[model samples]
Target chain A: MYEERHHSEILEDVLQFIYPLIILFGLYIILTGISQPGGGFQGGAVLVAIFMCRYLVSPREMGRLDLIQKIDKLILVFILALASMLILLGFREVIPYFNGIYNMLIGILIGIKVASGLTVIFYTFAFIEGGKED
Target chain B: MMPVVEKIMYIALIIFAFMSVQTPKLRRAVVYLAVFSAGSAFVYVLLGAPDAALAEAVIGSTIATIIFLSALQKYKAFTVYYTNEMRHEYRQSNLFRRRNAVLERIENFCSGKDLEAHIMYTTESLQEVMKNHGWDIIVRRKNNKFSIYGMEQNYHIEEMKKYIDENFNDLRKLGYEIELHIGWSENE
Candidate 1:
């Protein structure tokens, strides 16, 4: 119970800037990842994890973000699908981005996946949190 | 397989993540997120990305976490107000700032009304805004073709736009650029 309360307040506040930063951060991790560490999965997961973090951070701020959530989610899905599908298309015979140059595309897909997955988790949690008086 | 240290860091991350998940309030979750990020940073360090690790620490532990707590305060979030003034500052600041900001926005709008434009700029010539909403009306030519007479608005550009639109239209029609533009904002 304390955990929930503590996190709820914290997550809510963090979302103000964290969400945008997370997306930016994910991009940073992915784009720079090839030459360095942090490939698709970790970077992408981190991106989406931001959403979950945001959701957990600010459940009550839902009213403010209601429209944003819906529209943003739709856009996110399209982006992720497009990115992954593009990569998949490139891999007609073999996995795309055999070279590291196109690896950024893969990183993007991973980031999108991470973003969407966690967004869903948070979205559901927010729904539940809103349903009851806490 | 990841390193033992990395594995341990991962475990810490998971534990923190779970803590955030189990924690109901937003503030606690934010703090947990910070902790989780710190743990992830450790894993990153273990994996040889000290830069990423440092970033995570700064972002996760300090900046992001503080903001998250602030949001909770905004939302009447879970509380640990150890002091009255601290509680008062947290509780009142948002409301006050928002209220003032709204009023300021409105006042900015009101002030932008150019209540004295007819008196200020005659049906004159072209001028330039030095900065945002800076009204550099060329009352008189200075040091050759150089212009003068300027006023910078500290208000939303939208309000300034309305002022320009309302007061300067005649000038605009007369081929006098109002030297003012309304920016994109809530007023739009």
Candidate 2:
């Protein structure tokens, strides 16, 4: 059942070239989401492609999933806290220009949450659960 | 032209959806599902919902497919080791055909039980294979006699024993001796 890890030079090279570009694009989508069609969820999903590509490069190697899971939970709490504060403090009424900033902040937070959440799920299925069979 | 393109995308979506559901192999079904997702994403974009299209394309087509593939990889896989002692005799065309026929039957049985059959032919002796490798089934052929070895705890062994007994009667009549050694101990 133990087999040698297969390496594809072409895949490695191409992914190396596009890795930074994908990150930049995902960040761009999330940051500009307040003014554009793309938003946190979509941008976060795109960011997941980075980890997926990493998996393709090396099936056995994955970043610390527990850390990502922690980040996901922490982001969820932050999003909830921010939303409640906005509602309770009546910040929207007092500060007219705060709307755009709040939207952008929320968008960025959701994007990070979605990215980390999906990464955790993907790695769990691909490696953690699958490793038991071996 | 735009309407025609939309119609074609809609038709592709239907076809892929049906194929994903109807395909027998889990891996092929996953691919079909990915294609279905991509087709639907296109339809969404055409309908002016770029946001939904982006979500479907990334999640359904890419992430879901990868997850399904990894799950399938860890699913039930039936490994069979085939060793032939009569290396010279196995070169004969008829013996090769007979060996393939036996493997085909085993494959059919595995598919019926929703298992993927992986057959490996090795020059190593049956005893050596038993000692070194993890296997669901081992078929060792010494001339016309075939010894099938399997573990006691494997649920499929009993079913396979019945299958061979029922199906290999013709080979028995042809002077082939097929023996089933169930509950085979690893130490022995």
Candidate 3:
């Protein structure tokens, strides 16, 4: 399962500039998503594209899994809280101004959850690399 | 307008993603995952989400490949793990090579077949009552680890342990965490 890391190529510099632009475009698409066709899944998948790009060029140099994994777990908790808050606050509480804030917070929460969830896509490969020996 | 082409590309991306998941081998899976990441990144560009595409290209593909490869070298490099958890006794000794001086000295003890006669087992009175066995069990230096290979001797696990118990003064011991692998001529 362990793979050797290929040396960094000259193409990395070019890839670096390219990935961030992709992120910005994804953000814009997802933010305007309320009226647009795409929603959280598409936006998050697009967001993970940046991480994937770096992995393709030089997979060995990467080690962001621990950080991403921890965040991924937290995002799920935040998402659950947001969902619960939405149900309780929207149907039970009759505050219009608070709803707007709640929606905004939910939007932000969704972004974090989406970003974190996509890390699993990367971890499927990482699990291959992880093993203990005698 | 060629809306069909766009739909085909989306379908391809989705198929590619699932294909990555379907790969049986870890390396092949990683390769598919890389392809999936690249394909998705392209989809990102088409979807007008260039930044997300970039992230997929950078972190998803590159970093994942890197970590997986490095991990293989130390632990699971080409080590096949069966999904069926059969409790098998596997020997790690075949994969390990030692180049220690004391071990070299022990191996070079050329007096043939009976080095134990020359070896005197002494706990240094630091721990045990001295017993005189015909076999000369001589090891020096307390708390130092010793690698002893038994040739044509299938010493029982308790007997091997007794060696450590008897020779504490010059033995590096694996207390409570010791592992024993019994091998015979028929066992590889």
Candidate maximizing lDDT: 2
Every model's DockQ: 0.03, 0.61, 0.07
The per-residue C-alpha lDDT of model 1 at residue B118 equals 15
Give the clash count for each candidate: 34, 0, 53
lDDT of 1 by residue, B1-188 (tens): 56777777777888999999987445567878887887888887878877677557655675456545544434421111011111213344654555322123323434344221211222222322222222423233222221223334433344444544565444346544334322323332
Between candidates 1 and 2, which one is better according to lDDT? 2
Report the TM-score of chain B alone for all candidates: 0.38, 0.74, 0.39
> Docking category for candidate 3?
incorrect
Q: Quote the lDDT for A73 in model 3.
A: 86
Give per-residue CA lDDT, model 2, range B103-182, as digits (tens). 77788899899998888887788889988988999988888888889988899999999999899998899898888898
Which parts of model 1 have CA positions greater than 4 angstroms off? A1-22, A49-98, B1-40, B43-188
Task: Tell me which of candidates 1 and 3 scores higher on lDDT.
Answer: 3
Better model by DockQ: candidate 1 vs candidate 3: 3
Off by over 4 Å in 3: A1-5, A90-101, A127-134, B1-188
Q: Give the TM-score of candidate 1.
A: 0.34
Pick the DockQ winner: 2
Query: True-contact fraction for model 3?
Result: 0.12
- For candidate 1, the chain B TM-score comes to 0.38
